[model samples]
Target: MLDINHIAKTFNPGTITEKKALVDADLHLQDGDFVTVIGGNGAGKSTMLNAVAGVFPVDRGNIVIDGEDVTDLSEHRRARLLGRVFQDPMTGTAAAMTIEENMALANRRGKHRSPFRWGITQKERSMFRDELARLGLGLENRMQAKVGLLSGGQRQALTLLMATLQKPQLLLLDEHTAALDPKTAAKVLHLTRELIQDHHLTAMMVTHNMKDALQYGNRIIMMHEGRVIVDVEPEMKASLRVENLLEMFEHTSGGKLDNDRMLLS
Candidate 1:
């Protein structure tokens, strides 16, 4: 349902500070394909997502969603077509808004402006309650509670829920669980798996964790130096061990594995 063709991006072009973030990058996603991406600091994993999101215009390329060409579309235009969750748990939700209030905003997204009531309509309120209840966080009872009062894990969970409220054409998760503790991260990941499968949504998750990368999606793509280096299916990825990934990384990146792997390990 998504197609990226010959995309390229560079920061500070022609200056000493110039960095080519993506070069001839291309990717395609089926209607419900779930893809997990992994790479070190400058592998262009996040750049690919940002490029698709129109955070910054690519120097060249085309972005098509379903069947429409969105290459010239601004970020706001693309926003309605895609849902994104950043690495920072703080980025996705409005802290001051109540749980139901935040959800109300998401629910009404991409609609014509009206003086319609904000917090929750009678029908939507009930649906929100039921959905939040499914998270098992008792958030259904805390509808009026400010999102800021919730923990990081809780907020991320809510972010995940909100992003999917309208079923965007695509979902972009950029290192979504990197900040949480192990247990909390696991919980969020499990919730993520459940939600993605339940909705049969097309998603791309960029992560630093190798094990999680292997265990989650139907496909995995490893990036290095602004391009995709390895794209493997779940069966092939399942046969891969961390050592194999490290070796593959070195071959693709043309350098020794950085200390980040050691630190993460």
Candidate 2:
């Protein structure tokens, strides 16, 4: 469960370069709630995610996750409570590390560190293999291969696995599949759905693809000008088509849909 209460953030405030990223932004996710967030560029999509992740202190707001108020906590302090998969495949995992090695590192995340020892045990390797096999990407067989050798989709899938390995209280996916080709993106998205369901994880996914937004989540939220403009529940979102979403966006935000990428999608 997560709650973002009346959060507002502005960068370079009181200056010519000042930009208001989030204004009176409030969102809440119940246990196992998978919410898809869609908005055009500069719509505060990533800003909201980063704010929850504690990428920077929100100027005004309290973020609570599973009953803990983490608004003042440092990013590293909150990292233990949240799992994030970035847009870039290269961002999450160590390139030179073998798939198994990377997983070993992820497995130890959020745990108390001990400086005395290191090495993957047989049980961990077995668990990692079982988990990798679930992705059906043949990563189980390539456990010993360096992660740098994996394709973008493969790497993203593996990163997804890594992010959920600890079953964090919330999962933040920031346009994670955007960089992959369409076919590969679909595979990664499928894997994402499978993992979230299998773990009963609460998640927020930011996406530019309208169809993907409507097709995947239990709820869909449209953001505009730093605020959540439209929030649709499962039943409503299920019956709604892309054109309907566009119409809602125009009506609610009172601005034309200026995102060409979203339109083309």
Candidate 3:
């Protein structure tokens, strides 16, 4: 579970270039809640996740994870409990490491177990094979290959497996499929839904694809100018349409979406 209360963040405060990224933004996620977020440029989507991930300290307010206040924790400290997959395919895994090595690192993330194992134990190896096999990507056979040799889609799948291997307290995915080809993106999304359901994982995904946001998740949230402008559950508006979401964005934010970067990018 996650709770963010009255959080605010500003960059270059009190200067000519001061940009307010977050303005009293608040959000809550119950255990196993899979919420998809969509917004135009500078809607504070990533800023919100960055605050929770401790990538940067929030200017104000509290962040609690399942009752523990982590507002003041360092990024490395918070990482022990948070699993994140970034927008860039190049960010999550060590490209030089073999697929199995990358996976083993993730499995040992928060543990204080034996620190000198150069290779996976027989049991751990079997577990890794089983997990990779679920993706149906033939990665189980390519475990000895370097991760850098994998295609973007395959790498993303491997990252997903790594993130869940430790059974993280929360999963944060930031536009994870933005860089993949459409066909590959769909494959990754399918895997995402499968893994979330299989593990009963609580996840918050920041996405630009409106259709993807609407199609997936139990809930959808639209953000504008650093605050949630619209939040709806599937049951609340089974008839919701894409046009309606755009209309709501213009309404609650008091500004038409004119950013070509958002509308046409």
Candidate 4:
């Protein structure tokens, strides 16, 4: 459902700050394929996701989603095909808006909004409540509460629900659980897996945790210096351990893993 062909992105080209975020990176994801991305700092993991999301135009190559070429499409245009959860919990939703209000905006994503019809209907409210209840966080009762008042984990969970409310062609999770405590992170991760599997959604999750990269997704890809060096399929990933992944990285990238956060995770 997603194809990235020979994509490359170089920031501030011809300048001293030139950084090659992606170098001829290529990847393909079938429908319902959930892939976890792991790499050290500046490994182009998030860059590839942003490129697919059209955050910025790539220097070269094409990106096709569901058979539609979106390489030249703007970020807002691509929003119709993508549901993204950022690394920061606060990035996805309006803090001042009520929970139901935030959900209403997500539900209307990519649709023409008429100012004449701006209020949430009772039916939509009921649907939002039901969806919030599925999170098991008691947010259904607090639909009228401000999103800013919720905890980090609660906000992230709500963001996840909103992102998948209409099931985009692809879901981009940029370390959506990185800021939460371990327990809360696990809860959000579990919710992530459940939602993706239940809806048969295609997803790419960028994570620093090796165990998480191995445990949550059907396939795993490791990047280094802007290139995808290792792509492990489901069959091989199922039998691999954390140490095995580290060894693979060293062998393929020709260097030891150096990210402290990744190592500790």
Which runs in model 1 stand beyond 4 Å of their true positions?
A: 115-119, 259-265
* 37-135: candidate 2 lDDT, tens digit per residue: 998889999999999999999999799999999999999999999899999999999999899989988988768864116778888889999999999
Q: Model 1 over residues 1-265: C-alpha lDDT tens digits?
A: 9898989899999999999999878888888878998887887888999998989888988989999998899999988999899888897899998988888888888887542455367898899999898888889999999999999999999999999888888999998998888899899899888888888889999988888887888888887777787778666876887788888878877886554843374
TM-score of each: 0.94, 0.97, 0.95, 0.98
lDDT tens string, model 4, 1-265?
9999989999999999999999989999999999999998999999999999999999999999999999999999999999999979988999999999999999988778851276998889999998999899999999999999999999999999999999899999999999999999999999999999888899999999999998999999999988889999988989999999999999999899888889887
TM-score of 1: 0.94
Best candidate according to TM-score: 4
Those runs of model 2 whose alpha carbons end farther than 4 Å from true positions after fitting are 114-116
Write down the TM-score for model 4. Answer: 0.98
* Per-residue lDDT of candidate 3, residues 169-223 (tens digit): 8899999998999899889999999989998888999888877877788888887
Worst 10 residues of 1 by lDDT: 112-121
Comparison by TM-score, 1 against 2, better one: 2
| Worst window of 10 by summed lDDT in candidate 4 | 109-118
- Model 2 clash count equals 0
**Model 3 lDDT at residue 63:** 99
Cα RMSD of predicted structure 2:
1.2
In candidate 2, position 95 carries an lDDT of: 97
